[model samples]
Target: MSDTFFAYLVTLAYGDKETPTLAQVVFLSENEAEDTRTVARALLQNAKQTAPEKTRFDWSTLKVHGSQSLSDDELMGLVAAAAQGQVGVGRVSTLKLS
Candidate 1:
């Protein structure tokens, strides 16, 4: 079976719905889907602490499995949070598993 990857831009906050600081998670082509999703969530959670509440930190055009996962509401929130320098996304990960 094929694998998937998820790039995260986590917020430097405690809230699950909070903006991200600057993090990403990549799903390996050789990893299980369930495991990859878990890794993505965790990475986002970890990146939250680095966000400052403003900056162009919102994740955009990020190649991954679930851009749709970032719903319209969520995107709006991310934009607002990023405008306030809440977080920043930088240096995406290159997850590879074979």
Candidate 2:
């Protein structure tokens, strides 16, 4: 059986005045996802407190499966190739949330 990994596409937004930042974080299991979310929330809260304008910080998470369980280097290379291939991908970042 192939190893599977969970990837969470986290979209962070600070009010409606600015565009949301997109990030992908990959984890090995549900427990890791929980831990990662806790850290993410704390960081966002701090950001909300220090913003120039007072705006509520919100984030949405989308969970996906990496069926092939690609390594971090492999994933980075793939994203780079996609960007170079005129795929319209600005920048793809994958966070290692082990």
Candidate 3:
């Protein structure tokens, strides 16, 4: 049987604002996803140092929009889109299967 993977859709806010300005999708085990979220939160503490001044990403706004199980093919497409830099600043976990 193939291993099951969970996809987490995360959005990062640049400042103390409530709205998110950036989005990223991460695929991993449930536990790993939780751990990654923690790390993301820690990174937010240094957002100013990490992101350029022109890019307004409020680290305090980081959040997990949602999560779901992804089939192998769907996961592959996400990987492909990430490789091609086509994800942009939007949701990627919901891409339809072709």
Predicted candidate 1 versus true structure: per-residue lDDT over 1-98, tens digit per residue: 33344333332331244542333323222323334334334334534544222212234543233333456676556545644545343333443435
The lDDT per prediction is 0.38, 0.33, 0.36
Question: Is 1 or 3 the stronger prediction by lDDT?
Answer: 1
Better of 1 and 3 by TM-score: 1
Model 2 weakest 10-residue run by lDDT: 55-64
Candidate 1 ranges with C-alpha deviation above 4 Å: 1-68, 92-98
Candidate 2 contains a number of clashing pairs equal to 0
* TM-score for each model: 0.29, 0.22, 0.28
- The better candidate by TM-score, 1 or 2, is 1
Off by over 4 Å in 3: 1-9, 12-65, 89-98
Instruction: For candidate 3, write residues 1-98 as lDDT tens digits.
Output: 33443444444232223553343443223233344344343333323245223222232223333434446675444435434433333322322222
